[model samples]
Target: MRIRAVGTSALMIEVEDPLAWFAALDAARTDGRIDVTDIVPGARTVLLDGVPSVAALTAALRDWPPPAAASVTGDRLDIPVIFDGPDLAQVAAHVGRSPEGVVADLTGTAFRVAFGGFAPGFAYLTGLPWSIPRLESPRPRVPAGSVALAAEYAGIYPTASPGGWQLVGRTDAVLFDIDRTPPALLTPGRTVRFVIA
Candidate 1:
């Protein structure tokens, strides 16, 4: 792990394993070792905001170890989805499987939220045993609640926007709500299951 200064009050810790880095930070926070306002985790780094100084944070992290288990145990969310996406057949063909087979593969496996990016409430899920390719040409607009997959990640479109991920289904679950205490339904460390509707 490598720690670097980010501006005056933030420190960015670069790690080879982001999940482990997040777990360590979470452990530190739970143990009252961290004195920061926010921790933003990316695919490869974590940003600590509102820290007093990089030196202090670095010293604190020097003795911190990544937790053997995940510190954040989020609620399990089961989402019901209708297999009626425009790219469903295309995805199936690309994977050398029938549509039913593709759906079976998706529903048979459980996924975990690794991180959030691209859009608010857009969680890049991990644990997909198989990989899928992105579209050669991205769609101009993907409808809200679209369940899509690209590479090794699965995601739900929090809101309508342009996207390149292959859509395989649609879910009614609200991924984000401004009025909610935590706007994003799929937070990091949360486990997700997709049920065929």
Candidate 2:
């Protein structure tokens, strides 16, 4: 738990794991009186953006201790997915499981927002059992809402873009919409449970 001055109007909180950092940042949001514009969680740091000034923000964070953050509220979205991806067979073969089994295993689990990167609203969901191999090659164009898996994480393509993850299914969850207030279905530390429907 370290705070660094970010010019003016910003503070950066560094932590070992970004997911853990998210927990702390959300806590600060509830406990402090600072207006945060953005909280960008890195692998080992959290960038707290949009503040009044550096000196004031630094002083404000001094009172903050890394404690358990309140559970972030995430919309329980039901996305109907069609489990049809080219990598379906490959992923199952790597794990010595059938493709149907892979789908079943994937759908039954819930995930959290480890961080947000790779693409807008794309939660770098960790805790995907932690034994899967990282993607060898990224696809040129992964369709929007594509369900994918990688080492220790599973993700959904918020929008159609290039990505490097094992595709399993496609969801219709509107992860990002400009009209929406936050414009994302997943937020830091928010639980995400997937269903086969």
- TM per candidate comes to 0.92, 0.82
- Please give the distance, in angstroms, between residue 9's alpha carbon in candidate 1 and its true position after superposition: 1.3
What does candidate 2's lDDT look like per residue over 1-197, in tens digits?
68887776777777656666566666567777666877777656788888767787778667766655435556644557788877889889988899998878777766667677777788877557535675777788999989888877888999899888888888888887778977877877777777775
| Candidate 2 local lDDT, residue 118 | 75
Off by over 4 Å in 2: 17-24, 27-32, 59-63, 69-72
Cα error of candidate 2 at position 95, Å: 2.4
Off by over 4 Å in 1: 69-72
Candidate 2 structure, TM-score to reference: 0.82
Question: Top model by TM-score, which number?
Answer: 1
Q: Candidate 1, residues 1-197: lDDT per residue as tens digits?
A: 78898899999888776766776776677788788877877877888898976788888887766546544457778899999989989988888999999899888877888889898899998887678999999999999999999999999999999999999999999998888978989887778888988
